[model samples]
Target: MPPHSLLELHDITREYSLGKSRVNALRGVDLSVSAGEFTVVTGPSGSGKTTLLNIIGCLDRATSGSYRLDGEEIGDRDFDALAEVRNRKVGFIFQSFNLIPVLDVAENIELPCRLREEGGRNQRALRARVEALADAVGLRPYLHHKPDELSGGQRQRVAIARALITEPRLVLADEPTANLDSATSQHILDLMLRLNREQGVTFLFSTHDPRVVAHAWRVLHIQDGKLLSGEYPGVSRRASGAS
Candidate 1:
């Protein structure tokens, strides 16, 4: 593992049993995502994008090989241990903007802080965090609104705020802009980029959008459970082009 790598997967393999047969989701895949890097993973459907994200987010375990997060080996941890790691170290932004319909923006944003038992984040501190994130994402005016009352873009911003509430080391965004329009997608992408740069928070996203690919500092192309190429900015235009 590289010294600066916050996440590392070494010859990782994950297989799912289907009756007497097995399906490989990831096969001997070696990947490393360094701290403060905005890395994007792109591939066609069934290309192991979500599977890889889940493994890195500690939401799932690989069937074989080694995995590490922040230099700690995680392949041997149980499900509960994985959950704990995810809660403490990883933040997630989903395509669907999984906000509770009944909760207001402030409540939703502060949810993660409350979950970790990180006391002393009183109502005032929580409000401060929510307001800062809302302002960052251009959702400050909607702080009192419910999820159903906001537009798709606004709700997604709320989700982004919630994801950052914990100040996690890594943010795992799985198709975060998939549901938004082109203009809205650009806005959301810009917000994520700003957060990654300003906060020095590492971001890893799984996306198929060429726009998303264009914004990434590094791109990983995966196909059929294999890593085909790793493209860094200005290195390989052909490889960077989305397939």
Candidate 2:
């Protein structure tokens, strides 16, 4: 892996076993994401986009080949080890907004720090961080509200804040805007783009939404468990005269 590469995958493959058959979710995927790159992997349903993101995010392991994150070889780590790495190095945002229904916005954003293997964080400092992230994601006003109390866009904002609170090296968002309306989706995408640009956050998204693809800094196309070689680096909505 290059010194500047935040993530590298070499010929990665993943397979699943059924009662009497097998499934190939990924095959020979070679990818390297440089630090702070806002890249999106796009494909139709069942195109392995989610599988690839899962492997990269450490939520799942590959059946073959190597995976390096921050120059560390972690593909073969056991479940417990992987969990540790995930809590320390990766953040995730999901389409469902995955916020705990009972927890208020502030508590949800602060959850990751509490779950860390090292549990001696200062309460004052953690609260400060959570509040800062909430402000950054436009959730400061909703800090005391539960997930059920916010609108769809505001809930997604909370999820984004939660993902960023850990300051993870990588953030994997799986179809994050799937439940949002078109206008709300654009707002969410703009928020992500701002975060990526201002905080140097590295984001990898798996989605079939053309609107999301339109905003990506780099787009990777996948089909049949293989990545195709077309990228629109630095091309986006602005280039197409769309506001």
Candidate 3:
């Protein structure tokens, strides 16, 4: 295992039993991601990009192999334990910007702490953290605005703030820029890159978008449930013509 790796996967495989035949979603995937690294996994629609991200994000389990998150092996944990690990150590930013429509920006960002009930039960400190992240994502001015009141970029920023609210070791984004326009997608990517640089937050996201892949410092190619080694910004066997 690499020292201080936020995520480590060894011989990871996921198989779904389809009647009598089995479909492999991931096959012997070995990957290591260090803390504070910005990495993107890219592939075609059925190349298992989302499956790998889901496993890394603890949303699903593997059929076989070891997974270490923040120095702890969690692959064998039950659903409840995995849920706890997710709430405590992992954060997610979805493509749809899954925010509560009625909750304002601040409330949405502060939702993680409320769910965990951590931080020594100190509301004041949590509020301070939320504000700091809001400022970092440039959402301070819109902190009181509802989701519908903000632009797509602004809503995505709010989601980013919420992801960081738990101070997680890893943030997993599934096609985070899929719902945004080209310009807004680039803007959101820039903000995320800045966060990774300044705050030392590790980000691992999956996408088919070449624009987003181009911005990653480290690019990984996944195809047919395997990790491919190459000199990227090149496309994989399954990808064509830049998304």
Candidate 4:
């Protein structure tokens, strides 16, 4: 692995048992992501985008390969160990905006911190950070509103804040803008781009949205369980204010 690499995967492959046949999700995929990269993986449905993200996010293990996160070998870790690494090192945003229906915006954003079992968190500091993140994401006014009371975009904003509140080393988002309108999708993308530029947040997304792909610093294209030869730095780096 390179000195600055935050994620490295070598000849990774994933297989699933479906009914009576084995399904290949990934075929000898190799990838490397350094800290602070704004990258996207784009592919058609069933082309392994979600599977790849799951492996990288520690939600699922590859069938065979070596994966290292921040220089630590974790491909073989057990479920409990993977859960620990995931909680401490990764944040996630899903297409469904998985917020609790009963929790208000502020409560949803602060949930990750509270889930930690250590229990030494400074309550005042946590609240401050939560509010600051809510403000940043344009959810300050809706801080007291529950998910059912907000628009789809607003709920997604809350999800974004929740993901960032943990301050994880990497954030994995899968079709984050799928449920929003075009305008709302653009707004969400802009917010994420600003965060990536200003805070150096490393983001890895699996998206079908071309607009999202257009803003990426790097793009990886996969197909039929194999990576095509389209991995390259996107031309939007300077135009999008990426450092």
Query: Which candidate's lDDT is highest?
Result: 4
Give the lDDT ranking, best first. Answer: 4, 2, 1, 3
Instruction: Give the least accurate 10-residue stretch of model 4, judged by summed lDDT.
Output: 234-243
TM-scores, in order shown?
Answer: 0.92, 0.93, 0.90, 0.94
Query: Which stretches in model 2 have alpha-carbon errors above 4 Å?
Result: 1-3, 117-120, 233-243
Q: Candidate 4 at 175: error in angstroms?
A: 0.5
Worst 10 residues of 3 by lDDT: 234-243
Q: Write the per-residue lDDT of candidate 2 for residues 50-139, one digit (tens) a residue.
A: 999888888899999999999899999988999888988999999999989989999898888888822364888888888899888888
- Go through the candidates in order and give each one's C-alpha lDDT: 0.87, 0.88, 0.86, 0.90
Predicted model with the maximum TM-score: 4
Global CA lDDT computed for model 4: 0.90
Candidate 4 regions off by >4 Å?
Answer: 1-3, 118-120, 233-243
RMSD of each: 3.8, 3.0, 5.2, 2.1
Per-residue alpha-carbon lDDT of candidate 3 for residues 6-60, written as tens digits (9 for 90 to 100)? 8899999999999999999998999988787678888888889899988888889
Question: Which candidate, 1 or 4, has the higher lDDT?
Answer: 4
Give the local distance difference test score of model 2. Answer: 0.88
Clashing pairs in 4: none
